[model samples]
Target: MKWQNALKDYQLYLKIERGLSENSIENYSRDVKKLMVYLESHNIDEAPTTITTEIIQGFIYSISKSVNARSQSRIISGLRSFFSYLVFEDYMTSNPLELIESPKIGRKLPDTLSENEINDIINAIDLSKPEGERNRAILETLYGCGLRVSELINLKISDLFFNEGFIRVTGKGDKQRFVPIIDVTQKYINIYRNEIRNHLNIQAGFEDTLFLNRRGKQLTRAMIFTIIKQLAEKIGLKKNISPHTFRHSFATHLLENKADLRSIQLMLGHESITTTEIYVHLDKSHLTNVVEEFHPRRQSLKK
Candidate 1:
């Protein structure tokens, strides 16, 4: 098979067979495509079924000079998945990636906004323009639904279930879940949709998309990032923040307000509770209060 065709099939396998979301499939595809681009540019023709580990290793080594360790690591992971898919389909007898090692890296915690800071950031947006209303709604959904940037970009108008007070979110792996929506968030979204989005000449394929660009096409991921970045600048908050700050703030604020970790995990669409446990760390006051209230002898004495 041609390398391009093999890459496409591998992507489909990852999606349909492995049940990965579009965003994840894109990342995996991007990693594999880097190798394709490298091979093409160098006039080195090798089919996916015949490529060896040495070629991959050398390509990685050549690219390492220009890219950061984190990006390089992600590319390696993507390549490994591609080879594993080949093994799964019996096209390859063994996985060449089994012996390759990923660079070890420490987990970095993302920055989160305080509830007040989030409120202030929203207040900073000038809602006079048509895009302003949409921007406000975007921030609401990002914080309220705790959606990833990709999920936000692809969110469908049909996904809103306001009558049920829930929104159907398509998360990583194209996994769908019904997350409860706050009334305040729904109100802003409807305002933008009815007042602004209703008048726009929407594109054919993206008719059901929630957020849109001026051309009435679906908003790009970079545009969303740019929106958030500009809002951060206006508010004059100096911490390094991204669209993910809203998601982290959503989880952190919930945990601080005594929301259950399991519930937060379900809302965030985390497959493992361990991933959600990062937000479960209690503040000193809560820890002290728990100690004072739950101590058996102290409770008996107080009564």
Candidate 2:
């Protein structure tokens, strides 16, 4: 089969069968496109079905020189998924990537902001500007809800269930979950809504969108990044941080405070408890505390 046809079919399967989000589908497709580009540039005439492991290996080797190990591993994983799809469809008898292994890499821990640092960043916002209240609310929501930047921007006014003490979040793959919203977070959001958002001449389609730009349209992902970056610079924060850092901080803080991993996993909308386990590595002291507080042997010794 033609490379283009195979990729097109794979994209459809990812969307319909795997239920991947558009962003995820794009990332997966890009990996295949990179291989296609490599093939064309090298004048290698090979169909998707006929492409050998050696050619794929050569492409990976060439890419390793230009990209980091993490990126290289992701590309390999993406290609492996694509080939596995082909095998499932009977396009190939065996997967070419079955024998290939992703590069061994260390588990890079996420960066987290201390409670004081987070407060400093929020405090640094200039309340004089028209968007200042909105910005503060945005930061509060980010740290408070531990939302992905995409989820935060796409949040709608109707999603707020304050009386019920929850906000419905649509996470990756359009999966919805209700996350508990604290009173402080609700107060800041209410301030922005009443004082700032209420005054904007909101565009027709974005009427329900929670966060809007000065033009009264939905905020872009880059806008969120820019906002946080400027805030970090203003506060003289030494560590590099992004919107995701707030999420990491939320999980790490919860773990440090003796919050159960399973609950954090549910709140974070992680599919696996393994994903939430990374926070355990962030604070070994929390684990020690758990043993000291609940271990029968420790309790007996204390008695």
Candidate 3:
């Protein structure tokens, strides 16, 4: 079969059978596309079913000069998944990537902002501007709700159940979860809604969207990053941060304050507890406190 045809089928399967989001499907497709491009540029004419492990290895070797280990590992993983899908469908007898091993990359810890830094970034916003209130609300929602950039951008006014103190978030794979909202976050949102968003001549389709651009449409992910970047610069903060930093800070702070990992995982919409455990690495003191407080031998040792 043609590589393009196989890729098209794979994307459909990812969407329909696996129930992955569009963004995820695109990322997965990108890896296969890279291999296809490599084949074309090298004048190698081979279908997906006929491709050998050596060709794939050559592609990996060619990319190693340009990409870091982490990215190379991801590409390898993506391609492996695609080939595994082919094997599962009986298009191939064996996977070409089955013997390939991903590079050993260190676990990169996420950067987190302290409470002071978070406040400083928010405070740097000029409240005099028309979008200031909206920006503030956006930051508040991002940090308070521990939302992913996609989740924040897609948030709707109807998703807010203020009376119940919960905001519904649709996370990866279209999975929905209810995250608790603090009163402070709710207050800022209300300010933005009543003061700024209400005045926008919202486009027809974006009527329910919580955050809007000047064109009265939903905000883009890049727009949110730009807002945070400007704020960080205004405050003279040096650490490189993005929209995800707030999420990491949110989970880290909660863990520092003695919140359980399971609860943080639920709020952060992590698929596995292992994903949430990364935050524990940020605060060794919290673990010490846990041991001191809960360990049965602690009381005996104190006596």
Error of 2 at 269 (Å): 0.4
Worst 10 residues of 1 by lDDT: 280-289
Pairs that clash in candidate 1: 21-173
TM-score of each: 0.82, 0.98, 0.98
Candidate number that wins on TM-score, 2 or 3: 2
**Candidate 1 similarity to native, TM-score:** 0.82
The lDDT per prediction is 0.87, 0.95, 0.96
* Candidate 1 regions with alpha-carbon error over 4 angstroms: 37-47, 50-56, 198-208, 213-217, 280-303
Q: Which stretches of candidate 2 lie over 4 Å from their true place?
A: none
Best model number under TM-score? 2
How would you encode candidate 3's per-residue C-alpha lDDT over 88-200 as one tens digit per residue? 99999999999999999999999999999999999999999989999999999999999999999999999999999999999998899999999999999999999999999
Leading candidate by lDDT = 3
**Count of backbone clashes, every candidate in sequence:** 1, 0, 0
The lDDT of model 2 is 0.95
* Deviation (Å) of 66 in candidate 2: 1.0
lDDT of 1 at 261: 78
Judge candidate 2 at residue 60 and give its lDDT.
Answer: 91
Q: Rank the candidates by lDDT, best first.
A: 3, 2, 1
